[model samples]
Target: MYRVLIVDDEPMILKGLTVFLQQSGVSIASIRSASNGEGALAAIREELPDFVFTDIRMPVMDGLALCAQIAEMDQKVQTVVISGYDDFTYAQTCISYGVKEYLLKPISKPDLQDTLRKLIQRAEAAKPASAYLSVAKMDEWMAEIEQAIYYMNQEQVTQLLHTWEQEIATYHMQDEQRIEMLQEFHVLLMKKLKARDVNIELRPLLELKQGMSFHTVYQQFTGSIQDTLDSLYRRRKGKLKDPIEEVKIYIEQNLGSEVSLEEAADLLGLHPNYFSVMFKQMTGETFVQYRTKRRMEYAKRMLGEERYRITDISYAVGYADHSNFTKTFKKYEGISPSEYRQKMGI
Candidate 1:
């Protein structure tokens, strides 16, 4: 919704306009009454309304003069002139100050509505394409340019970049100083990309100067840089997916009471059956075999401690039954757990 401010000398006119506007489609954020141009100017500065409707004649400053001052204050404000006079010359003069609509006094409902509608449409059209730089309005266009490079929409990047380059060409920006700063920024970004081993090459600085708006061009450059970073991240992640290695790490960390294939599969977010097949394919051993190997490795470590019994060691590595642990260990190592400990001199 566009924010509108009604400025007029007469209290009745202000109230009538406010009430009429409130009933209309427009959302009136503020209704300000100014007996003269000074009050209106202050209100305009404070609220920074999207649309300003002012009577042409007022003390201190007339609507035409006030419009000029507002134009200087912010070029984007939409001004509409309301006058009792049928003077075409004054209306033409108002036009020079970029006044959108000229409405006669004792404003009719339909006429005011039509005038507001056209004013709104024109205000929207005159607005800068993107709200990002246009609304906040950076002092140095290059600052906006740099920010746009990182966070703007993907499609607008190219067009904005082109516009910025053209602006740089025509603008009397101190070539040596701006160029130096631009180089430093570009090199810094290049270094960051290089440190991450991102393989894509950024466009050359000299090649970026075809755009009219500096901010637009820089936004495009930054957008491309972000895209490259995203692509690199995806590629890096693709090389690190080792399901069997990941499962081994998880199982090693959590092999205790009640450790099960379902638990192991869930840790890696894989179905138990699929995990079982993949584990064997990658490691040349079933999950059951891998678990047994891990349990034996732990058993050896426990044996070295010489403080825990065979039954204790069995349950320590997730085995519930002592007899099952002894049977599995003997089958794999050709000896009982106790005998193996003694033979190994642990």
Candidate 2:
């Protein structure tokens, strides 16, 4: 079943299209109507519709702009332009925006049905290929990419990106699929950095431009990741006694043992109270909170590997009591360790 959104300035046209499509025998899951492009955009952001039928002229945010925005958001959304004017310029604009169908005002029911049938067929044909990697394989690929980034292995990272690009080309993926894959990769990169407790500005990396070439996008994104990692590395080199950095390394290396605030403070050769205040000031987290977060992250990574029993994982991450480990894992992750492993398809 598919969700469809219809947009027009005319209430009657919107109502008519909504009713017609709902009853058009097209397996519609839901039908929504919007009187203008602005409202349609809001609805799309809330829940992207599989199909959009929109008029060209509206008071605010014309159909051409709306279609362009939709293309940027998701290229797979099937769009049909219903316009009263039969202007060549409007048709050309819609064509550039990838509108699949254009119908004149007072569209015939049969014509609409034909267009929808063709769209449905195209959508079914465009489903992810059977040979696409399974979830577990994808997760492993992402982990390898993250490891490459962690070690500042630019050669490996570039080779991996090239391999991915070749794979996308081999599959002849559409622009929509390419964008989706890139976005997923970007998300995994950010999550890996976060799990490592690296703080870096990501606004430029996140703001994807419409119609950017895949090569250019990948270069910029990978460059940003490398730059951020280099910056963090340099900072560490210049500040070997950096308390936050020390604590992060210590926590990761000692996740299987009890790492207390006083112990960490003593390692830094500072009074416990002073170290506590300094740790909070430097990392914006208390010692216990930071250690727990790192342990949880380590536990999650182990869970993704699928070899360890829950009880063994609990002991591995420093919890002596199985129930206590489960409780803390649930508190940190909002799910038990076993549930997390299941969700990861382990």
Candidate 3:
């Protein structure tokens, strides 16, 4: 005979849940409803309910804020968050507030019934709740993990993970709780990798194995994160030493010559078409555009120096025709070479 309160902004949801629970054959001593968290808090002040089923997004106050208030006002009253969002951060926040359950929206009858049954059984047994990590502590750990990943500090990450496992052992966390925490940590790791443009598929790494020890699972998780960072580092290092980069250097050194795509590709032992596509993808510009831009930049610097005549500067930048060089320079710089030199007071 547990008193229950359902809080949601939707009138349909509030009415539907109330009716469904009332007829579910569960021993709900009394059921109440509120349009939002504010109303729910007001109702609780009037008469504290044994359980609260709340929607995460509601007017005036959200379910997370309500859960925090409940934790402070009455730790005995259990809460179950119902939300459409499947975000791991939300689950982590709710768990920190001692939320008994988190049910996704479009809630099924069986899930609701099962959640209710578990809460009722706990209420009947009168078992004391176990201590869990505080929200602030969990946040601190997450920030440390993020910082480790940002700097690719594998040693720091491994140490932090080992410390986390020890914490779980100290707390005597249940199997379900351990898995949930790991899953949330996996989400954070994947998010960090994605921010750095590491596009590896994470599903395989995130899957929890059956009958594996928590320490083993955590080691594997740490390995996966390390593997991703290693792969990204290797790829970046390889790019610096690759033939494509050599081709770029060659282009810069021969800016005064007729640098052709075919010649550059041949130097790298690649087909011209393939090299063209790869260069565009990597540098975000065509080979001709890059060469032309570089040549124009060099021309401007030489013009400012006034060491050579305009005709000599034009030939020095791979332009054999003075009229053609002036036309191209005006196209890119909005002025002829002589006009640019005059403007620069050369």
lDDT of 1 by residue, 295-332 (tens): 78888788777788888888888878889988888988
Please write out the lDDT profile of model 2 over residues 1-346, one tens digit for every residue. 5789999999889887886775453445689888788999999888888889999999888899999999888557899999999898999999998897999989867688778867776776677765343333344566677667655566887787677667666655566666666666576566545544334323246567788777677777767766765765785564334456877888888999998998887776556755786688678889899888888888888888867888888899999899999999999999998889778877
Return the candidate ranking by TM-score, descending. 2, 3, 1
Model 2 TM-score? 0.37
Give candidate 1 misplaced runs (Cα > 4 Å): 126-346
- Provide the global lDDT of candidate 2 against the true structure: 0.76
Q: Which of 1 and 3 is ahead in lDDT?
A: 3
lDDT of 2 at 160: 78
Candidate 1, which ten residues in sequence have the lowest lDDT sum?
131-140
Best by lDDT: 3
In candidate 3, which residue pairs get closer than 3 Å at backbone N, Cα or C atoms, i.e. clash?
Answer: none
